[model samples]
Target: MAGHTSKRTVGALPDTTAESPFVPVALTWLAWVLFAASVAALAVRVLFGGDWAIPGVVAVDGLTVLMWVVVTFFSGIVHSYSRRYVAGTAHETRFFVLVFGFTVTVMGLVAADHLALFGLLWLSMGLLMAKLIGLARGWRQARAAARVARRHFAASSGLLAVALAALWWETGATTVSGIAAAADTPGGSVWLVAAGALVLAAMIQSALIPFHTWLLSSMTAPTPASALMHAGFVNAGGILLTRFAPVVTVDSALMLAVVAVGGASAIGGKLLKSVRTDIKAKLGCSTVGQMGFMIMQVGLGFFGAAITHLILHGFYKAYQFLSSGERVEHTAPDGGTGATIGRVASVGGVVVTLLTGLAGGALFAVLTGKGLRVDSGLLLTFFVAFTTLHAARDAVQQTSLPAAARYAAVPVAFLPAIVVYAVVYEGVSALLTVEPVSTELTVLHVVIAAVFVGIYVGIETGVHENSRRLYVALLNAGQPSSDTVMTATEEYNEY
Candidate 1:
C-alpha cells in the first residue's frame, strides 16, 4: 500500500511540471507585445516631431511615449519575475490576469488627453488595484487591506471627478492641451477653487500623512502587486500635477498649501520609517516620504525635477519590492558605532559636501551649456549636497584609518556620487519639455529648507534623545496589532 501511494505521488509531479511553464509563456508574450508597441510609438513621435491625437480625447506625445516605455518595461520585468515567485500558487492564472489588466489600465491612463477620459481611466485603475489587493482571498489580512484601499480610493475618485468637472466647466475645454492653453488667461475664483480641488485630490491619491493608512495596510498583498502599486499607481499624483502645471502654478495659496502638506508628510513619514521592523511596511513608509518630496518639488515650481524624480523613483521602488525576497545582512544596527560623528567632524563633513556639490554642479552646467536656474538647479544642488554629507559622515565614522587619511578620503570618496547625479539630472532635463518656472528664493522657501536641514542634523546627532517618548510614539504609529480594526467588518467578503 505504501509503494502504491508513492507511485501515485510520483505520477502527479509530472502534471504539475507540465502546467508550470504555460502561464509564464503567455504573460511574457503579452509583455513583449506592449513593449514593442511602445517602442514603435516613440519612434514615430521622435522622427515625426508631432503628436498623434485621437481628436480631443487621447494624444500620444513625447511625455506619453516616455511614460509608456517606463510602464511597459517595468510591467514586463515584474510579470516575468512573478512567474517564479508564485509558481506553485493555487490562483497563479488569476494573478497574471489581474496584473496584466492593471498594466493595461495604467498605460491607458498615461495616454489619456481629455479630462473626461483621464478621469475615467484613473477611476478604473483604482478599481483594478482594489481587485489586485484582494487577490489572496484566503488571507484575512489581504481582505482587510483591500477593503481599506477601496474606501480610500473611492474617496479619491470622487474628488478627482469633482476637480475635472470644475476644470472642464471653467475652461470650456475637455482636452488637457486646450485647458492648459486657456489657463494662461486665468479665471477668477472658479479657477482657484478648481486648483484647490485638484490639490486635495492629489493629496489623497498620493497617500500623504493623514491619508497614508491605506498604503501601510496594503503590505498584506503579494509582492508583485505591491511593487506595481508603489512603483506605478502612487505616482499618479505627480502626473496630475505635471499635467496641469500651467494652471496649478498660478495659484500661490494653493502652492503654499501643497508645500506645507508635503513637508509635514515627508518629515512624518521618515520618522515612521525609522522605527519599522517589517520590510514591506518600511518600504511603504519610504514611498510616502519620496512622494512627499516629489510633491514638494511641484509646489516649489520645479516641474522638470518632479517629473525626473517620479520616473527614477518608479524604477527604484519596483526593483526594491521585486528583489525584497533575498536576505541581506543589516549594515546599520541600532546603537551601532556609526550612528553619530563628533560635532566638529559633522560640521566639516557638511562643508566638504557643499563644496563638492557646488563644483559638480558648475561642471555639469559647463558641459551641458545650460546655465544654472535658481529654482530647479539650486534645489538639485542642495539635494546632492545633503546626500553627500550623509555619505561623508558615515565614511568618516566607519573607517579604521588615521584621522588625517579619513578626513582626506571623505570628499574624494563622495565626489563621484555628486557628479553622477548632476550628469543624470542634466540629461533628463534636456529630454523634458516643461521648463522650470522662474521664481526668486522667497523667505518662506529658505525657512523651509533650513528646517529640513535642522531635522536631518538633529536626527543624525541624537537630538531626539530629549524627546524619546515622542520619537517612540511616531515609530509605533502604523504597525498593526490585534486590537487594530483594519476594516468595519472583522472579515471582508468582497473576494
Candidate 2:
C-alpha cells in the first residue's frame, strides 16, 4: 500500500514537459495588426467625413485612437513579459488565447460606435477578466482575489445596464452618436446626469477607488493579468470619459461629478499606497491615483492633458509589472546600492517639499493677482498643500542622484502649462467679469500639475519599501487566510 501510494503521488506531480499554450507572440502580432486597422479607420474617418454624421466620426476616431495606441502598447508589454515570466507554465498557450480574446474585445469596445455595442463588449471583457482572475495559481490568496474581482464585475455590469437604460429612455436611440446628440440638445440635463452616473460605473470597471478594491484583489492573478488589467484594460475608464467629453460639457453638474470622483480617488489611492506592502498592490493603487488624475483633467476641460497623462502612466505601470518578475520587486534602475526608504520618507521628505511647494504656490498666487476669487483661493490653497506634500514624499524616496536630479524639473516643466492656463483663464475672466480669473486659481492648476510631476519623478528615481508593504495590505485587506482556502478546498474535495 505504501509503495502504491508513493507511485500515485509521483504520478500526480505537475507536468513540466509542456509549455504554456498562451505565449503572447502570436497574440502580440495579431493585436498589432488590429491596432493598425484601428488607426487606419481613424484616418479614414478624418479624411472622409463628408457623408458621416458628426457623432459617428468622433466616436470612431476617439475609440480607434484609444485602441491603436493604449491597447496595442499594453498588449505588447504583457506579451513580452509573459515570455520570460510564464515560460515553462503549461497554460502559456491558454493564457495567450485568453489575452488575445480579451484584447480583441477591448478593441471592439473602443471601436464600437453604438451604445449597445459598447455595453456588450464591456460586459464580455468583464467576464473574461473575472475568469482570468480565477485562473491564478500558487496562493490561496489568488482564489479570494478572484472572488473580489467577480463582485466588481457584477457591479460594473449593473451600472452599465442602468446607463444604457437611461440612454435609451432619453434619446430613443442606442447608438453612441444618437446619445451624444440627445445629451447635447437643450433640456437633456436629466438624461445626461443619469448617463454621467453610469460613466461612474465604467470608472469602477477601470478601478477607481472604492470600486478599486477589486484591482488590489486581482494581484493574485498571473503577472500577465497584472500588466494588462491594471495597465491596459484599466484605461477603459479614461477612454469612456474621452468618448463622452462632448456630452460632459453639456451639463455642468456632470462635469463636476467627474471631477469630484477623480480628485477623491487620486488622493485616496495615493494615501492608501503609502501603507500597502504588496508590490502589485502598490502599482495597482498608483494606477487608481493616475486614473483619478486623468478623470480630474477631463473634469477641468483639459482632455488633451488627460490623454497625455494616461498614455505615459499606462506604459510605465505595464513596464513595472512586466520587468519586476514574480517577486514584484521595485528596484531602482541604476546598478548602485539602493536603500529602502519605506514610510519614513514621508516624515523626512516634508520639509524640502513644503518649501518648494510654498514657493511654487506663491508664484501662482502672484499670477492670479486681482483675479483671485474666493473659489480660486480655495483651489489654490488646496493645490499648494497637496503638491508640497507630494514633493516632500518624493524627495525622501529618491534612490539615486539621477532620480533626485529629475525632481528639479517639476517647476520648469509646469511653467508653460501654468502660463497657458493663466492666459486662457484670465482672458475668460476679463471677458466675463462676473468670474474674473484669480491668480490663486491659476496657481492651483499649476500646483496640481507640479505635484503630479514631483510624485512621478520620485517614483521613477527610487522606490519605497512601504509601497510593497502597503500593496500587500491592500491586496489581502479583507480576504481569507491560506488556511481558510485549504479547508474550503478540502471540504469541497478539490485537490
Candidate 3:
C-alpha cells in the first residue's frame, strides 16, 4: 500500500494537464517577428550588397543578419516548444523571460559595433544562460550546476574583456569596425595578447575540451532551455571569431594554434561522448566537438564556413535536444551497437568506399574552389573526405546489409549530402565575400592529420575499447562535479 501511494505521488508531480504560462506564448510571437526582421535584413543585403551601420555603435552585415535569422528561429522554436513543455511549472515565467532576453541579446551581439556594447551583450548572454541552467530554484543540484556555469561564463567574459581592451589600446579604436579598419597597421605585443585572449574567450564560451565541464553539469536546465543553449547560446563563440576574422587571421601563428586546439577538442569531444550513458551528457560532449569544427573553420580563415557550420549545427542540435525525451530506448538483437564487430571487408570494397569519399571531396573542391590549392584548403578538403569516409565505413560495417548493398550505399545516399553541403558553402562564401585566410602548408598540419586519423581508426576498429584505462579516463573526465549530481529522489523533486 505504501509503494502504491509513493508511485502515485511521483506520477502526480508533473501536472501536465495544467495550462502553460502565457509568457512563452508572447515571447514566441515576438521571436518570430525578430526572425522576420532578420529575413528582411538578408533581402536588403542581397539587393544592395552594402552593410548598414551606425559607424561606431551597431552594424548589419551579411554575418549579422544571417546569425539573427538562425538565433531568432531557434529562439522561436524553443519558446513555442516551452508553451507546453514547462506548463504549470514554477520556472515557466522565468525560463521564457530568460530565453527571450538571450535571443534579443544575441541579436544585439551580432549587430554590436561598439566594443563596450559587444562586451556587455556577451556578458549578459552568459548571465542569462546561467540563470536558465539553474531554473529549478528548489533543487540544490540545479543551483550548483548554475554556479558552475556562472563561473565559466565569468571567466569567458573576463578573457573577452581583456581581448577587447587590448585591441582598443593597440588600435586606439573603440569599435569593432574601427579596429578592423586599423588592421592594416601592425599590432605588436597588443595584437598577440588580444588574439590569444580572443581564442581563449571563444574556447571557453563554446565549451571546448577542458572548458566543457560547465555544459555537462548544466543538464539540470529544462529541455527547451537546453535546446536553446545548445543551438543558439554556444554558437556565439564561432560568431565571435568570425566577427573578428580580420584580427585573428592577421597572425598565422595564432591561427595555427587555434587550429591545433580545435583539432584536439574535436577528437576529445568525440571520445568523451562515447563514455556517457546519459542522453544530455552525450549531446553536451557532441556540442564540444561541433564547436571544435566551427572553430577549426574559423582558424582556417574560412569564417563563412564557420558561420554556415554553426547555423546548420544549431538547427540539428536544437532538434536533438528538444526531441530527446521522445527517444525510445532499445537494444540491438545480438548485442553491441547493432553492427558486426569483427566483420571483414574485401580490399576492393575498402577502395570503393574510399574512392566515394574522394569523389565527394573532389565535388566540394569544384563547387567551392577550396581544395584545388595546397593552402589550408587542402586540410578542408581532407576533412570533407574524411567525413565521407566515416559515412561509408558506417554503411559498409552494417552487417545487416548484403555486401553488394553496402558497397553501393555511399554513392547512392551519402554523396548527394556532400553536394548539398558544397552548394550551401558556395552560396554562404559569396555572401560573406571574405578573402580566404591561408597558412603555408606546415609539418603541424601533417602531424595533426595523422594523429586525428589514427585515433579515428583506433576508435572505429574497437582499439580504444580494448583499453580499460582510456575508457575510465574519459568517463571520469566527462562527469559533472559531485555537488551538481542529484543522488536522492528528493533532490529530483523539481520535476
Candidate 4:
C-alpha cells in the first residue's frame, strides 16, 4: 500500500495517471507566448502611454498598464508551469483551454472602462475560476467544491452589478472614470447604497472573514490553478477598491466602516491560521490575512500602498504555492543546533528589536515623508515599524547562533529590507500619481488601531490555547465544507 500510494506532491492527487497519452500542451505554450507579448507591449505603453481612453470603453493609463503587466506576467508563469503539472491528466486539454481564455478575460477586465464590459469580464472571471477548481471531472468532491465557489461568485457579481448600475444611474456616468469623477455629487441614499454594495463585493472576492469559506473550500483545485487563483484572481478586490477609491472616501462613515471590517478580517485571519493543519489551508488563511491588510490599506486612503502590497504579495505567494511540495518534513525537527533559547537571553533580544524597529521607521519616514501627522500615513508607519520589529524578533530568537550574534543579526537583516521596501513603495506611489481621497485620522481610527494591538497581544500571550472554545472555533472556522475532503484513498485514486 505504501509503495503504490500516489505521491502527495504537486497535482497528482486530482486525477488518475494515464499510459502515455501524448499530452498536447501547445495551447498552454501559446498562452504563455501571448502573455509574454502582452507584458512587453504593456511595459512600452506604460512608458509612452500618457493617459488615453477609447471613450468609455478601455483606458490606457498607469493603472491599466501596470495591472495588465501584472496579470499577464503571473498568468504566463502559471501557464508555463501547468504544462508539467497537468501532464497526461484526463482533462488536460480542457484545463489549458480554460486557462488561456481566463488569461485574456482578466487582461480585458483590468483595461475595461465601461460598466458593462467590466461587469461581463468580472462574471467570466468567476465562472472560469470555478471550472478550474472542478478540473477533476470524475471527482465528486472537486465538483462540489466548484459548485460552492460558483454560487459565491455569482452573488459577488450580482452585488457588483447593483453597485455599478446604481453609480451609473445616480451619477449619470457611463464609464468608471466618469463615475469616479462625479463621486462628490450629493446623490444622498443612492451613493451610500452603491458604495456599500461595492465594499461587500470586494469583501467577497477577497475572501475576508465570513465570506472566506469559498477560498477555504477551493483546495480541491490543482496546484497550478491554486497558484493563479491565489497570486492573481483573489487580489481583484484590492484592485477594485483602488480603482474606486473616490466613491469609498466620499462618506467618512463608510470609509471608517471599511477600516473596521478590514481590521477584523486581518486580525481574525491571523488567529485562524494557527489552527489549520493542511499546508494549502494555512496558505489560504494567510491569503485571507493578506487581503485583509490590503483592504485595510485602502480604507486608510493609501491606494498606492495597497497596490504595492498586492503586487509584491502576488510574487511572494506564487513562489509559495508553486514550491509548496518542498515543504514536507519528517516528524522530528532537523537541521539546527537542536537547542532552544533560554528566557533570560530573550530580554536583550527585545531591546535590539525595539532599536532596529525605531531606526527602520525613521528611515521610512525620511524616505517617504509619511509619519509626521495623525493621519493614515502615521498608522502605516506604525505598521511598518511593528512588522519590522516582529521579523527582527524571529531572527534574534534563532538558537543556532550565539546570543551576541543573534542579537547583532537584527540590524544586519532589517536595514536592507526596510530600505528596499521603502524604495519600492515610493516607486509605486509615484507611478500611480493619484493622491488619497481622504487622510483624516479620526478618534474611531485610533480606537480601531488599539483594538488591533490588543488582538496581537492576546495572540502572543497564548490566550487562545488557554481557551478550548476559542481554539476549536478557530479550527472549525478555517475548515472547508464537509464534502470537500477526500477521506479514503479509493475515493481519489479510482482508476
Q: Name the runs in model 2 displaced over 4 angstroms.
A: 1-25, 35-59, 137-141, 186-193, 326-495
Q: Pick the candidate with the highest lDDT.
A: 3
Q: Write the per-residue lDDT of candidate 3 for residues 1-495, one digit (tens) a residue.
A: 233434343344444334545566677789899989889888888888888889789988888888888888888888777877777777777888899998889889999999999999999999999999998888899999999999999999999999999998898999998888898885888898898898899999999988999999999999889999999888889888888878888888889888889999998988888778778888999999989989988887888788778888889999999989777465444554632133336885688678888998898888788889888988988888887877776677677877887787758888889888988777777777456686787889878889988987777677877778987998899999788998878768674
Write candidate 2's Cα lDDT for 1-495 as tens digits: 233434343234333334434335667667677767756655665556422333542244433554565676677667655665655555667677788788878877766777777878888888788767766455455666676777777777777777677767776877766766665463465566556666677688778766877876675567778778877777777767666655555655565566667776776676667556567667877788888877775666545445555666777887788765566554645665443333324433445565556555555557655224454344534453455555555554566655446356544544454555445444323321022112223454545556655654554444533366755664454333343243354333211
Going through the candidates in the order shown, the clash numbers are 0, 25, 0, 0
Better of 1 and 4 by lDDT: 4
Error of 4 at 313 (Å): 1.0
List model 1 lDDT by residue over 1-495, tens digit each. Answer: 233444343222233335576766687679878989998887776677677779888877667887787788888987877776666677678888878888888888877988888988888888888878777786677777788888888888888888778788888998888888887788888788778878777877888888888888787677988998888888888888888888788877677667768877777777777667667888898889889888887887766667777788888899899878774444555675343224435565556655655665565555543336555346545654555565666676654787677777776766665566556666555545566664565667667778887886776676764576966787667664332234555454324
Which 10 consecutive positions of candidate 4 have the poorest summed lDDT? Answer: 336-345
Regarding lDDT, does 1 or 2 come out ahead? 1
RMSD of 2: 9.3
Model 4 lDDT per residue over 296-352, tens place: 888888888889889989999999999998885535545663222122246798899
When 1 and 3 are scored with lDDT, the better candidate is 3
Instruction: For candidate 3, give the lDDT of residue 248.
Output: 89
| TM-score of each model, paired residue for residue | 0.85, 0.68, 0.93, 0.91
Per-residue lDDT value at 97 in model 3: 89
TM-score head-to-head 1 vs 4, winner? 4
> Model 1 RMSD to the real structure?
5.7
